[model samples]
Target: MDEFNGTEINFHCMYIPFCDARDCDRELYDSPVDCPDCNRGMVALHFTILILMAIFITMGNLGIILVIKRNKIFHNSFNMFKCSLAFADLLVGVLVVPSGAYETASIMMRSFDPTALNRTDYLIGKDVAMIRPDSMCDRIYQEDIGGPGMFLSMISVLSVMASIFHLVLLSIDRFLAVWCPIKYNQRKALKDKCAISMIIFVWLVSITLSVVIPMSLGQRHFIHGLSPAMIFTLKTSNPSTGIFYATFGLGLPYLALLGLNTATGSIILIKHRNLVRRSSLSPSLNSGGRRKDEVKATITILVMIVVFTLSTLPAMVAVTFYNGTEHKKKGDATIRSIIYSTLILLLVSNSAWNFIIYSWRNDNFRKALKNLFTRKQQRQRAIIRWKQLKCSVLLLSEEKRRRKKLIKLTEASNSYSSEKM
Candidate 1:
């Protein structure tokens, strides 16, 4: 049996090793892993999914932004929150998804051409025959900001965290709107400043937590030159840091979102039920349309909350587990990696699909978007008609001026002839 070491298990392309039996030795080929064919298929599938997600996310978020910007009807506090969320999702699509696709493509390419992997010193030692495979593969860990890949990772992390914060803000906004309409109205009047402040705060906290704090911690860890055991014990194995980080970063916000959404949803349901009962008792009530609109809005919010929870839960569980665990076996690590990757894709999909949810659930939003596009077309046509009308008027004025000049010339000629005679 091949005894898998940490380095071998931690290699990039864990599903498909770069060095085959022909390139390296029997040991590389003897590893228990997914078949190369299946791995290639999986890579292709992942790349395709990510590319599609990026496209949808870009288009969807941009559409939401355009719709909100163009339509004055959507300029409320809740829509402002939606706009912020869309912007954050847009960043994920633009920055994160493409980067992930590129990395997946790189892996695919390396899988096909193993030599490309060997070209790097970190993958291949000075001597081919005496290549230290373990050290070579181990040196190239992920998420180190020494390159563009890591920089994208950092941005993605920032955007994702910002997005989650925006979601929490959105939930709170909905809660207040449903639970306290008068107070919500007052707050809504001051929404512009408040929304901007909240957005700025979200980004600041996201950057501090994801980038500044991590970098500082890493620097301290490196500067101290602690042993692996000490590092694990102090940082990874420390339950306090893990608990605090997980709770604040992922757990608490999600819990708050869930609670707020639930409360808001219940309030909406009760109000809707009461409205329905009243309308049934008095068929003359004109609130049927308004009730329908309210129901649509409530459904949209509930769908967003549900999607967010579903998409985020897996990654949250994986992170919390990894952070809390002292030691993980090779199989466990591999499984966690796969689970984490899948969950990340789910998270990206969550961001991408919110626009669809809005479109599907909210008739007003859909109509507003349709009207926006329709109005754009009408505006273009109006401009063209205006230009055409202006041209015709100018032509008619010129014709009149020319006729006057001709009459003057003819009259002058006649007068000159008569005088000569």
Candidate 2:
């Protein structure tokens, strides 16, 4: 049995490229080396994916923001929350996605020694080093201007957290409006101030979580020694921190959103059922339009909640379990990388695609967006009409002057002929 165990261990060691324990140490392999062709392809693919995602996110969020800003109909408290969410998503697209893509592309294109271990490999095991030198990492770290990478990392986290909080606020607003109509109407008087206050509070908390805590914890883990992807996973460096973040930062908010949305959905359904029964009993009291609006609003809220849950839950789970998993084998490492990238992409898509959801489910928002475009077209047409009218007036005046001049000349000629005769 002992001989068999020794043979199995030897076979495993033979398959590992650098099975020597000392070769895995960080200090020993600080030189740069060229990446394999497969890694290069992965880098290019991921970069293209991220760039496309950024473009979509930017355009979608910009449309949402512009629609809300231009249309007074969207100036209410609920829409304010939506606007806030859109703004956060816009930041993610502009700052986070591009920064990540650039870093990935740069890392892939550069030649490096294949002995240095990046942050992820270092975290998993000292034995797993990238087949690249540390010089590339050093060069990237030096190129950072006033820690732009760190700033982008914090902004990305901040925006995503803010979006989730804004969604929670929106759900609460809808719940109150539906469940307690009288109270909600009364509170509507203070809606503007309250909305502003809530938005400020969300930003404050987001900053504390994304910027303040991470900065205090030591930025080196993210800014100096880590890959762009690893920066977002900073919580996993320590088990306690990961638990704390998972429990408070993500898990609690997710549960709260789930509970609030569920309650809202239940209330809306019951109200709808009651309305249906009333309509059946008194056919004359037709509230079809109002009832339809309510149903549409309910569906929109439900769809938003479902999308948010689907996009964010996997990332939360991955963050929670990342430290506990074993990623020693190359296959396991590759799988882990793919999973992480997919989850991040999903989260980004959630931010990017909310505009589509709004346009699809909410008639009012769709109308508002349509009206914005329609108004622009109308204004252009009005300008052209005005110019055409001005040109016509000038031509008419010129014609009148020429006709008068001809009449005067004819009169003078007639007088001259009469005098001659």
Candidate 3:
């Protein structure tokens, strides 16, 4: 299924990877042609990673969101970036996983029937209404999946960019807050940041390509390749713009994020060590709890950046090498196949690894997990307290009412006795 952008014109593509044994392997070849064993392994590996990505990214991000929402201590400007990064990845996992899985299925089905795409569409009720000569089951796969796959890639690119930018901002925020707390706390200075505006701008720029690029293609269902549906086409000497975007959007920003965080975090940690050493002389330094928190946050961001970089770097390098001018000359097909397979693994793993970093490195994250699980205990305690208060209030009200009633009765009886006398 797919939809256009809303009032702001956000476009979306939903796809599932459904390549069969031959095409999967053949994708890495000089031309999209034959290769059986490589294709099957590729397909199997993609599907397997898709399942793991769905589970890990989704659950991990959900945990982060839960922690951020629940823990007041964790709720700060810097944490907002982490929340956004996790959220974007979470969404990417949700959108991409099924599409990837479907793509794998589409590929597999392709071997049995050339018209496998149309046949898949028929099962999903996505037929073009114009009958095509495909097996009914595969119609949706043809019309919907491929084009949507490209669009999904575009969206994923945007999400990744947003996540990176957010991380960068987070690092900056921490740097300011730690190094210059007074300035950071000032209303005027803090207000100047306007993170919300930055967020909007980032998303707008990111979302712009999906909506506007189609204008070049002239609002077609999908392009067969890079051919724009409309009149305009961008000719570039660089052969692999799409691949470049995919790699750079994820890779370069992460590299920058990692560097910026490392430099800033090291400075903060050094300062913290100094503060700790001089803890005896300065009463102010005694409240070094904030420094500790800063260290923990820094470590978490640094670890996340490292893990994301290492996990995804190989694929970026592989794609760059594969798309290089010498690729055709240097390739044993076997080596090329190996590179593509490795790239796929990296790409799949990239979407899933952040959660693992949090679980392993972040004490706050672990505490948040504990809080999430033990929420029922907290609720039970609250309920018990409420019940006791309610009971005490009821008893006090009953005693007061009884006293009033007795007083009224006695007054009435005394008045009657006086009249009779």
Q: lDDT of each model, Cα atoms only? A: 0.59, 0.63, 0.54
Candidate 1 lDDT, tens digit per residue, 27-140? Answer: 343321223323445545656666888899999999899889877888887888899889878987787677655543443243323343344333321122222332222222
Model 3 over residues 1-421: C-alpha lDDT tens digits? 2222212111111112222122233224322213333344554665566677678878888888888887887666666666767777786667755664565354335443443333323222222122222422133334333566556555555555566666677766766676676666563344435755655665665565443454354323322211101001111123455555555555566666767777777778788678679868774554467667667767777766666667556654653443211222323444554455555456556656766776787777777777687978589768999999999999999999999999999999999999999
lDDT of 3 at 79: 62
Give the number of the best model, judged by lDDT.
2
Query: Model 3 — TM-score against the truth?
Result: 0.62
Output the better candidate (1/3) by TM-score.
1
True-vs-predicted CA distance for residue 8, candidate 2, Å: 31
Each candidate's number of clashing pairs is: 0, 11, 34
True-structure RMSD, every candidate: 9.0, 10.4, 10.2
Off by over 4 Å in 3: 1-46, 110-146, 182-193, 209-286, 320-335, 374-421
TM-score of model 2 vs. true structure: 0.70
Q: What shift in Å separates residue 167 of candidate 1 from its native position after superposition?
A: 2.1
Per-candidate TM-score against the hidden true structure: 0.66, 0.70, 0.62
